[model samples]
Target: MQQQAPKAYIIVSNDKNEIQKTSAYTAKTLSSIIKTCLGPRAMQKMVLTKINSIEMSNDGNSILREMDVNHPSARCLIELSRTQDEECGDGTTSVLIFASELLNQIVPHLKTLHPIKVCNILRKAKDICINHLNTIAMEAAESDLINIVTSSVATKLCCVLKLPIPELALRSVQLIKSSIDGRIDVKNDIKIEKILGNFDECEIIEGIILEKEIIHSQMRRSIENPKILILDMPLEYRKGESVTNMEFSNKNDFTRALEIEEEQIHKMCGYIVDTGADIVITEKGISDLALSILYEKQITAIRRIKKSDSNRISKATGATVLNRLEDASPKHLGEAGMFEYVKIGKEYFCKLSKCKNPKAISVILRGPTRDVLTEIERNFMDAVKVARNVLLNPKLVPGGGASEMSMALKLNNSNDKEEKIIFRECGVALKVIPSILSTNSGNGICLDVINELEKKQNKDGPYFGINGITGEISDMKNIVLEPLVVKTQCIKSGFEAVMQILRVDGIIESKSK
Candidate 1:
């Protein structure tokens, strides 16, 4: 008997309704492949690239992006991941997981409808979903800032650990917010005095003080009256006379002029010392002769006064720098005179007399190792970025499990005439509600049991409501019943993913004939 070749399965339809088949099993197999990594207990994956390897997180977006999916639909999921990342910065996994599940739910219904009909329904559902989400979003309260912050942090922790300490999470949020609020820009040549042990003892001080060892052997161990000089100009002296082109006839004339210039620089320094100024702050560098005179007189000096720093110090201290060093004296120190220095850990804190703030806030992060510190820093920065957004926006809906439920329920009840076909094809789509509920319950039960044991073992508080919801618990609990939001986001994500996946359908090709 002659052998018969098997028929190819078509996965995509062209604009002219022509079916282009690849493999019939590809979409189904791809869907099942990602389903295993869906939930909280999902493991991490390590992906190696040409340059380096990235640690694989069970995060939906991360796993999808890391994988080399060849099928058209699977590739669409990757674009969906990118869209989620760009829009929310966080919800990448949720977008993909829900999207994959949505496709899975649609495949059976797709068997009954034309592919074009399925695509049309998807577009309509997307619009309905977006509208429903906007309505739910408006229901979010702007007054509940703390609840919003708590919810955001809890969501972050949920992705990292099944059972996270809510109180600790809240405390971390507060610390971050407080640190941002207390950030101070140090102005002037101030001292950072460390009061020994930790950051809590650090203080900021004004005025310049050099800790260098005294070079003069006979300089009174500590002069009772230390003369201070504040010069905001360069120590270099200009020629006494401006020589015209005719005046510069020979090198000898220039040499004598240079000598006289050197003498004037020495006289300037002598005058500064004579006026009892011990330290000088200048906007420019000091001449060699002037430096030598100050060194001989045991007068310490620092140059380079940044304009901003100078302005800030002037505003705070009520003292102006005299143009001529001869005029600078101790009497001109004004309110800026007092400064205290203390050593703390690796850095010094200089507390200026002018700053009247009661206390300085410092955030001390504790990590097991340097890498842990780096991770913590990265997480902190991410949180900070979100925090700023929340502060500016000040309105937020529920998140984590609650957010998932809200989206699901919103999609279910959404009523758009255009979306009727989608709802009809999927037939309320709530047939899978029981299964989702069952899975949600199962996941919750396992988490609850673990949390209960943890509470008993650790004697900590109850696990439920560890992080409170933005609105009433009832609202979040009824999320699955409100499928509009979930349906909308999912459909939108699906359409986008589908388009992107189709665009790159032939991305990988077989080289051999």
Candidate 2:
């Protein structure tokens, strides 16, 4: 018989004998990168991009997304990181680190057992983990909505603070929520209007709002009794009446047609006057006759609005024009009279309000510098997103280190009849539970402590070893666990992600070979 090509066993295989032996290596490397950033003591990573320069953050998702990865196995871990980012926005590092440890712990057993058998065990264990998580989750007490908001804000404090323990994070959360009497979404709907001179004079409003800037660069510093004109129609000349073939060469006929065009412009100006418009915003350039009429009325005019500068106005003030004004009255303009001009760079502000929606909310965050402000804004927005989800769902479980411990404990005690055989064959897999807890604690001494616990419980029921050492699941009924809520959401998010990943099995092969 011809000698067979050297055979090798690997966990994941692709054609051409390209074995995937790096999952273990990739998981270890990824875990080490994120382990240091665990808990409140975490520090930020300053990432430099090609054009944007740098971003400073300790956030796992930000770090993972910013980092360039080439290894296929590492990319899989990155996908898990993305899943965590999308679900909770925070705890991405925690999720990835936990997953890494879970995969690492299972590697040693792969030597004596088939990869498929390992996978089956893991599948059973994951199901038990989820079921136990559900039980522990039900045991968790309902969290106060206020506490949930406060806790979310607290987690973001490290990223938000400039001098470490900056007080504004708490105060901002309180201020944002104060208007709605603790209702999170209602508080978010409240907008900060503007700072009247200093921070003390800051005002908040509640309604649709916009921050408009001046239209013309040369407009006066301020116009007294400014006429406000709003129009929806174009200012170009209407189609001239079709000229007859004989009239094409006749200069006299051309002159008569020009006069008719001027008359149409005059008619448009008459309509503006009829509507009592003081300032005109038009879709097209004003005809000379219309311009003259506007000057006579002392009505300021801005042209080519949708094209000329609508984007800047929209971004600055967040106001959107719904319709063109036909006949506008002073009172109908509401606060439109309060237009004020302020200059920044080459831009001038002419704040206008149609009195349609009056409320404007501004979130003024105080930090050391502009970069800090940007980072704080990102953190605040992420927190706000998570807070909104909590408000909608209101159910939470332990997350981070706490979640890992809870799940391990639950799995040790989980008494599902169908899994008893696999549980026995696995030979006290629960013995590994304490090790999982120790890995997350980031303390070698804690690992020693867990090892001691495991030694004492080896004689107990097959799955009782981890339970004995890690201690029984206490009644979490009275205590409010903020991370738990985030954790539960994250697990559900992870399950959804895994299901999606499982839907596509095996990578597509290139036909070029």
Top candidate, metric TM-score? 2
- What value does the lDDT take at residue 317 in candidate 2? 33
lDDT of the candidates, in the order given: 0.44, 0.48
CA error at residue 107 for candidate 1, angstroms: 6.5
1-513, model 2: which lDDT tens digit per residue? Answer: 565565443334553212223555676797777665554445457788546668777667777777787665567778777876665555576566655555555545444555555455556666766665565453322435445444444435433442222233223333334234544432334332222222222222222223344344444444443445444565657653786343457768878877888877776777667655455655556666666666776566666664323332322233333244344444333224334455422344344433223233334444444555556655655565555455445565532233444455445553665344344433233323344444444445555655555443343311222221223322223223444445655544443332233233244433321
Best by lDDT: 2
lDDT of 2 at 388: 48
Q: Per-residue CA lDDT of candidate 1, range 30-90, in tens?
A: 5454544433333444555334654434345545665776665556566776665544334
How many clashes show up in model 1? Answer: 39
